[model samples]
Target: MTERHHILSDNAAALSDDAYDSDGFLIEEDGDDTSRPRLYDGDQLEREERAALRRVAGLSTELEDVTEVEYRQLRLERVVLASVWSEGTLEDAENSLRELAALAETAGALVLEGVVQRRQKPDTATYLGKGKAEELRDIVIAEGADTVICDTELAPSQRRALEDVVKVKVIDRTALILDIFAQHAKSREGKAQVELAQLQYLLPRLRGWGESMSRQAGGQAAGGQGMGSRGPGETKIELDRRRINSRIAKLRRDISGMKTHRETKRGSRRANAIPSVAIAGYTNAGKSSLLNRLTGAGVLVQNQLFATLDPTVRRSETPEGREFTLADTVGFVRQLPHQLVEAFRSTLEEVADSDLLLHVVDGSHPDPEGQISAVRAVLADVDAADVKEVIVVNKADIADPEVLDRIRRHEKHSIAVSARTGEGIEELRQLIAEELPQPDIDVDVLVPYDRGDLVSRLHEEGEVLASEHVGNGTRVTAKVNADLAAELAAYRA
Candidate 1:
């Protein structure tokens, strides 16, 4: 763990060296031109020559074994990243590639190198142009890389073609995100949802067996098969597909059951009229830390993408002592896979049903506006556009003041907070109290001394504006929900 942290810190430092300019493009470093091709020669090189070139480029040829297998053994993957820029500034392209590298690291991969090609659009067949694809093949062979990850989701043909040319596993951004979710999911429902998404993704990309799986079967007289084997044998691909389909069906049923249970829980919360405030934001935007800061729930806080996949609900009180539930939900990201969104709908419904959304943003990130836009896109997809939102710029301790000021100017109700240092937390709490739904009824009641629980409930669930002791009991003037008002009706003053 310490070693991983050190590696992550080092990577962060490397990423920070390049600064974004006014136009959001990285100012090319002194004595370095990004326009110059990393590979100069137009001719294909021999094996040794390609290896030498890779050595010069500092490429590594190590395959990170995937650790998400049933055995749960820890493994590290070494990967090379490639992206084709169809329409974006060089800096925008670089940022996208860097994000992919971060995702790869979160999935326990050591990033070897990242390469981008300027093009009008990704090649429909190979993602990169033919010449660039060939160049990539040589780079893969020289670097000893076993996998190449593209920055965008690839079509089935594109994936196959890239794999064929590079002679390595080829995956896209969506697959990488899904793998990270698979690693972090802890709860039964989380696990089920991730598995369902994986199956859905796999179902479409499942490869068919070639000639080896197409051999014809013979009858018993030919001594090649029995009565049941008079025709073509079941291809391995077919059997695998059938098994996957069965598992997918089972997962859907299981997820449905989980959804029902979740709805029941939500229904119970509603019946009690406890207002729910859901914390949501881009992945690694300090949401878990914020939740911990607010409620002291002590959730797992990691500086990695999609670190917390399971939802955690913790009880909290506003400054007025009005109790509510704060739910830490799964974070969103740019281009979050559709399969994951559909599969985790039940969990996301928690966000959709919330009385308020505390949309946290990493004010320190280079592209805070982009993060906000991406999160909003996902929220719209889940039909949560109508839900009330309170934009929160967290990590104020380390954020750029200019960025914070800009965000605050644009978002009137936004607050700058540092969950780590406790800066602006009290103000944030007060703001939450002010924004939350207030009690609808004001009541004056005299409770019997024996019914002290009602008074306690009043303090915990309502805003007790005033209180006094009377001979019969306690006289309280408070604003509360309908249920509490009904309970206090018997002792109405």
Candidate 2:
């Protein structure tokens, strides 16, 4: 059982100098929890922390002795999930479980079984009432599941309580989602964002890694430290907390620099007078395939959800010869972790700034409409609701006819296509070309035959409504963006 997400999310107590909130309102950590011991309030900290932290902060840590460990990758854990619904209907609870299953699958975990408990209120200390938690433990034991994933984000105490009772490692929805993100991240930028998010989430949970050792109230050095010793040497949990905070600060600054660079690049695109179309949809919806199909971009396309987490921008010419930029960004999901959205805020701006949006849907999904709702929910959250959108029902070749009809009936601006077979691709392309804003100016111009490359460019980058031949020169009437018009100004005769 969990608190209403909308109401609980705004609490400042939900955030810290180190960790931040992801979807499901769970805290994700990035670094050790016991670095700084100076920032705790009231009972969260113990005495004799500052002296411990100051001493440890002066200690030097070494990395030169590090050795690479080759790993036969750990076998992915197959999991069973449990959820308790307090205030919502059965439908809400089921939908939440389905999403959790998806998150588990995304993290490469096979969902062996699932259970949902209903109650008017959740037990404050244990989440599910005692009887239900015990029952869930039996289910996990029967299924021989490798792990237990909870639908709700669990507090440190709650996580421990449940794990102790369940007799297995327990991770809530937020951590499971983070694990998926950690695996899907592929770009330099993508990796950094995921690492920063993971570290931030890992901070607070550092309080007691199953050891009764009181975290040094000193912050980062909460474990223990001599006058200048790092590690768990006499530092309190507060010391670990401060170290994470400092690392978070550096990551924020780095991400900010990346944001500025993106802004500069965006400015350049605007100056070039090119329209932009950003492809957005739920994960695994064929966005990458569509981009490669439309523009020959050759982006690494994988079948997994969130496979295309980093944004890829490519230049493409519409059939009418107009050039525009098409960007592929991370997919939206039901309850997409807010921390990811916040951390990737600059990237989502790629969607917000685009001239048009292509909302791709996997027509084959069992709940296409639900997927649509999930995507729109995140879009609204990211401030992209006002952007013009065209729904593209992709993977139609394998979709159920009844579902397809239902989708088409409800979608006024939707089209169906299979990116793989090239089915309906031409119609989709024409629809895209016609949907863009029409340029206002139409002019006739003449250019010497030797400037044929310019002439070719005109054909590739404009709507050539008419043309005439005149003694080694071509006179043409075309509709084009203003920048191109200016470039052709001298050729007008």
- lDDT score of model 1? 0.81
Per-residue CA lDDT of model 1 for 16-43, tens digit only, reads 3445554544443546555321232223
* Every candidate's lDDT: 0.81, 0.74
Encode model 2's per-residue lDDT on 234-298: one tens digit a residue.
Answer: 44566678778898888888888888999999899888677889999988899999999999999
Best by lDDT: 1
Q: After superposing candidate 2 on the true structure, give the runs of residues whose Cα lies further than 4 Å from its correct spot.
A: 1-74, 86-92, 209-235, 446-457, 469-474, 486-493
Q: Where is model 1 more than 4 Å wrong at Cα?
A: 1-75, 214-216, 220-223, 232-234
The top-ranked prediction according to TM-score is: 1
Estimated TM-score for each candidate: 0.83, 0.75
Which pairs of residues collide in model 1? 60-143, 61-143, 61-144, 64-77
